[model samples]
Target: MSGEVRPRRADAQRNRERILEAAEAVLAREGTSASVRAVAGEAGVGLGTIYRHFPTQEALYQAVIVDRTRRLLAEADRPSPDPGTAFLTFLERIVVHAAQKKTAADLLAGSGVDPKAGTADVSRDMRQAIGRLLTAAQEAGAVRPDLRAPELLALLCGVCLAAERDEWSDELRRRALDVLFDGLRPRPLS
Candidate 1:
């Protein structure tokens, strides 16, 4: 009688990682609907192998989220000399790059995903980092002291949500963000 298929080898495990990496590139650069078979081909693996590692669409999507989280966290950990500028720049980068990564770009599109589903903790950490910057900025009178973390995140959500379907160019987005920042900046009354 024929036996069941054997488990994958070490090389097979490495190949699976490569496939996931390729899938990430495709999904981020393209969209969430990228084909699994196409990913296997890109990874130089067979269809059966792709099926072996991730048997379901949800599994693949989760993997994409986890991988993207790692990448974003790594980016967040990069050295920044100024906490305030870094905070604002990080938020701006998150907004622009959200549309650049398929997993997050789609999430930013209001796919009805739970805000803290997989990446909530990472977000909380990011907000804490920004909060520290916020405090520093307020002390320096560069930003309004009344602003709160949740409020800031909500405003960012608004920017990402509105910008997703807009016809604005990158330059336009940057300029528009500058306008938004102008409103948020502290000003002395005459």
Candidate 2:
């Protein structure tokens, strides 16, 4: 056989997608105690099928995170009539994801998996995507001129980590995001 890996059959690919969706839901609800068997059951697939696709819980969680991040980045890259709204919406969506993804993230951290282990490329793409949104917002006078992508990313991570750590209520999360976004807005001067 050639060195190149063969593409999955359509059914296999479909099953993999279903497993990821179900895994996300199960992990979000079950926290660090979720099992591959539970994911297989949730996906309506056999244990062998899940093992064939993802040999370990770490592998499964990493794949789910990478899959979700890529989808979010795709949405962030789309054109929007209001760059400011798009940028803020992206940040908000990330915070919401943080809340849903806390269990998986904590599990990964506890497993000694470097947060960036399999996600370096996606992380770079995410930064670039955020930079593009920030630039557009700055040009539109929707955000302060002094802000950079790194600082924005830092702020975003802080709030996401806080939201996850504190288990903030939806109302509190929205209020916190409002405060953060408000700080990003440009200040009028005399």
Per-candidate total of colliding backbone pairs: 0, 0
Model 2 pairs whose backbones collide? none
Which candidate gets the maximum lDDT versus the true structure?
2
Stretch of 10 with least lDDT, candidate 2: 104-113
Candidate 1 Cα outliers beyond 4 Å, as residue runs:
1-10, 33-48, 75-81, 105-116, 162-168
Prediction RMSDs, each to the true structure: 5.6, 4.5
For candidate 1, the per-residue lDDT at 79 reads: 59
Candidate 2 local lDDT, 1-190, one digit each (tens):
5798989999999999999999998867765468888998999999989888987777897787778778877899789999999989988887787787763233212223345466655666676777899999889889999987666777787777677677779999988888989889987783
lDDT of 2: 0.78
Error of 2 at 68 (Å): 1.7
Lowest-sum lDDT 10-residue window in model 1: 104-113
